[model samples]
Target: MPQNQPTNKIQNPETSVPKTPEMNERDFLNDMLTTEKYMTGSYNVALNEASNQTLYQDLATIFKETQDCQRNLYNLMFKNGWYAVDQAEQPKVQNAYQQFSGYKNQLPYAVQ
Candidate 1:
């Protein structure tokens, strides 16, 4: 005869400890879907609890700014034909200004 057992640990009346990390079904899933960072396992969802939401938001903003900088750099190089390995060392102040101007004018409201 086969034996039946409780797979999860009963932490308390309020919470159940999952048998495995992968078995956790809440918080991690929320993080993946909503770009919301999780405090614990996938299944452990935060119930609008008090936490540092601003810190995560700031991190997201920083990431976006970094992406924007990279895009601007690529566009600048493209417009000026700055294809050389030592492009930055080469004196092309006028080209830089023109490239920056083009990027500035086109970038706002530009869809990905």
Candidate 2:
């Protein structure tokens, strides 16, 4: 039986405690998928804060590619039953859409 060790001394139900032995595919994919998420976020930030138009476009393209990669990884994980995704409630989704669309056309932010 695999031992389920909590990441910290106190087990947090909301967070995952990765359990993979012999460096399994689930472990590799989870780590790569997670790291790609961070990379995508960094690319998005660079795109938003880029003072140079060329740099901004380059980052935007890279961000899109990273996003596609993340999606593919996620799909694979999901298909293999290695990833658990919780669907958002329709009301919650509607509320978020209303909130965000309220700021439509607003500049992402003032460039520093």
Best model per lDDT: 2
Candidate 1 worst ten-residue window by lDDT? 36-45
lDDT value, candidate 1, whole model: 0.45
Return model 2's CA RMSD, one decimal: 9.6
- lDDT values, one for every candidate: 0.45, 0.77
Please, what are the lDDT tens digits per residue for candidate 1 over residues 1-112?
2358433332223233366757353333333423422222221322234267785565556655555554555444434433223334235867888798788779877553
Cα lDDT for residue 11, candidate 1: 27
Residues 1-112, model 2: lDDT tens digits: 3477433222213333356556767778889999999999999888878999988888888899999999999887776767665556689999999887766646577342
TM-score result, candidate 1 = 0.27
State the weakest 10-residue window (summed lDDT) of model 2: 6-15
What is the TM-score of candidate 2?
0.62
C-alpha TM-score for every candidate = 0.27, 0.62
Tally clashing residue pairs in candidate 2.
Answer: 0
